[model samples]
Target: MIPVKILTSEEAERLGLKKPTKKSGFGIKGVGCVVQGKHGGEGKLMEEIILRENGDLELVFMDPEREKELKSRRQFTGYLKQFTKIPEGLK
Candidate 1:
């Protein structure tokens, strides 16, 4: 399973990501996901996140070209912190 960075609303802003919404019914809002490739380049599956009250985080890892060329976006998401790290630029 691929790891995805989990940034708080403030952290996301520092990294130029979207902010969390105060009115969101979800417990976690205004979070951002960033996936970095092994070749020292950033991945393109950038998106903001909202964690439903009882939902979980998910992720997947694959070659970039394959990820893009793949016809469907049936991706898996998870909240593991192995492949992900708080980006140095944000820290």
Candidate 2:
């Protein structure tokens, strides 16, 4: 596998990551959010259906394109840490 260049905070800032003005806020960037699930009211059909090897169905990410911004898994985790109290199941 190719080594990925991890972006420094300064580098991320140069790429349009504005420093959070709020106290206790994160100081990083290059992150995006994706959401997918039932919508248009309860019991509505999901937008995308994914069949897993375990035979479970999962919804397609609504913002897959946005998720491509992260360079590595660590970056993705850090980004989520900024806004989420991650559950043990997800961790």
Candidate 3:
């Protein structure tokens, strides 16, 4: 399973990610998780996985450089599983 890092609201804010909100399709009123992958010798931000109020998962990709490198959305997503941790519940 793909690994992920769950962020606290404060940490999310510190990272400059969009604030979790009930109104947003991606998140509820809680924090989201970060999905990182290896790139160019170090870990790079791949996407943010947010839990919707209805229990659906939302994926938000924030790295433009990785986007350019991968070209297609399918390739980008496939690459994310290469390095990361999946939370227990998600697993």
lDDT tens per residue, model 1, 1-91: 9899888878888886664555355454334455445676766654333444435332333434533443255433222242233323222
User: What does candidate 3's lDDT look like per residue over 1-91, in tens digits?
Assistant: 9799999978888897965565566336444554566565666565566555666554444456645566565675565454344344332
Best by TM-score: 3
Model 3 lDDT vs. the true structure?
A: 0.56
What's the lDDT for all of these models? 0.45, 0.44, 0.56
Candidate 3 residue pairs in clash (backbone atoms < 3 Å): 3-84, 3-85, 3-86, 4-85
Taking every candidate in turn, the Cα RMSD to the unseen true structure, in Å, is 18.4, 19.0, 18.0
Candidate rank order under TM-score: 3, 1, 2
What is residue 88's positional error in candidate 3, in angstroms?
30
Give stretches of model 3 more than 4 Å off: 1-42, 72-91
**Over 4 Å off in model 2, which ranges?**
1-62, 72-74, 85-91
TM-score of decoy 3? 0.30
